[model samples]
Target: MNMTLTENTLVKDIVNELPKSSDVFKRNRIDFCCGGNIPLTEAAALADISLESLINELNEVVEKSDSGEIDWKFWMEKDSEAIIDHVISQYHNPLREELANLSPYVTKVSRVHGGHRPELLKVYELFYEFKKEMLDHAEKEEAIVFPLIKMLDANTVENREEALNAIKELEKEHDHAGSLLKELRIITSDFIPPAEACGTYRLVYKRLEMLEGETFNHVHLENNILFPRFN
Candidate 1:
């Protein structure tokens, strides 16, 4: 709201300051996760967007966002247990439900449209595979990795090595999920529905796009915020 952000600020720091800014970065195709450490001006240049324009859009989004309802910076002050619980309840649980619910639409669309739109077949295959992998990934985080993280938070000396190892493995899984998301984006032409696309087809693409955004934020929280504190 105050336009406090500048081009020199790191992309991740911008997102950290205003979590809703992620939608702006995603829309602009700016990398605010693995490459998030880079300054906003550099990120804008890499994405082929004008720095002044991007900053203006981000500020506008920040101004409109209800920061009082959701404070991204609050996570920085939370203890590890509280953060883990928030991640589980907010990201992990919703991801599980959405992945489960969206699979049916994906299947139905591919069945109806795969003849003309052959890419739907690939989309169907990739999504199911991604879903399966993600379900397993979420399971590991909930059953194994998360508990270890909490243990580390409690200063359990024996859990440190195991927690670090588990986190490394989880990061690898995140990379695999990211790769699938990229493939999905490419196959769907950035999730644009074709001209003749039916309502269901459009819905499938829309949900897929939503899935991509949610997963990016979910992974960002873990890879950037959660893991670093323990590691």
Candidate 2:
């Protein structure tokens, strides 16, 4: 059952799984490109697409090639040190670098053209907020939660209760961060840049979209694969 997943498995999750699946996760007319968090039941009702059909499609893709790739799924089944190292080395730092360049561009573009397209100002604010949230979020994961996950994975029950407590706190933080992200998405209208926007404006919006996609994948790895396996 989907209980193999965490509580936050929204419709957007299906989108993330599709790319890795090789076929079943298509983006055409599917709304996967936009709001990936809607429940599958909700999405099916909205689009008149059948849940059974979606399941069968996924099954076909899975059977065709349990493709021997070291995908996120592979890492999800790992210890805390493994997941933490992968996130910091592979995901977080590169995102920070991208945001560093993008933040100034947002301010610059808004300064030059805010009078014409006020939406840029809002976009600028949301991007900065997201960056700040992400910075703190990464630190929390590395400092506290990850160590516990690693400890538990290694079957070190000496500090098991303490690690469990840390995980509970981290889960609350995750909920807050997710709420903020959802608000940002609403503010940006699914990150569709205005038609009259310049390249940087468009690029920034595109980057946000990409980050959302990546973050969903990241969260899925933790929530569905790593956390459950460790638990």
- Candidates in order, TM-scores: namely 0.69, 0.62
lDDT of each: 0.82, 0.62
Quantify how close model 1 is to the true structure by its C-alpha RMSD in Å: 13.4
> Per-residue lDDT for 54-157 in model 2, tens only?
65665554453224434764674566676778778756776676666556656877787778877767767777877897888778888877877877877875
Poorest stretch of ten by lDDT in candidate 1: 64-73
Against the true structure, what is every candidate's RMSD?
A: 13.4, 13.5
**What lDDT would candidate 2 get against the real structure?**
0.62
Residues 1-231 of candidate 1 have per-residue lDDT tens digits of: 444878798987776555456657867888665578899889989999899999899888677543444455777777878888888887888778777767777898899889999999999999999999999998999999888888788777485776799999999999999999999999999999899876557667877886897788788878888888975
TM-score of 1: 0.69
Lowest summed-lDDT stretch of 10 residues in model 2? Answer: 19-28
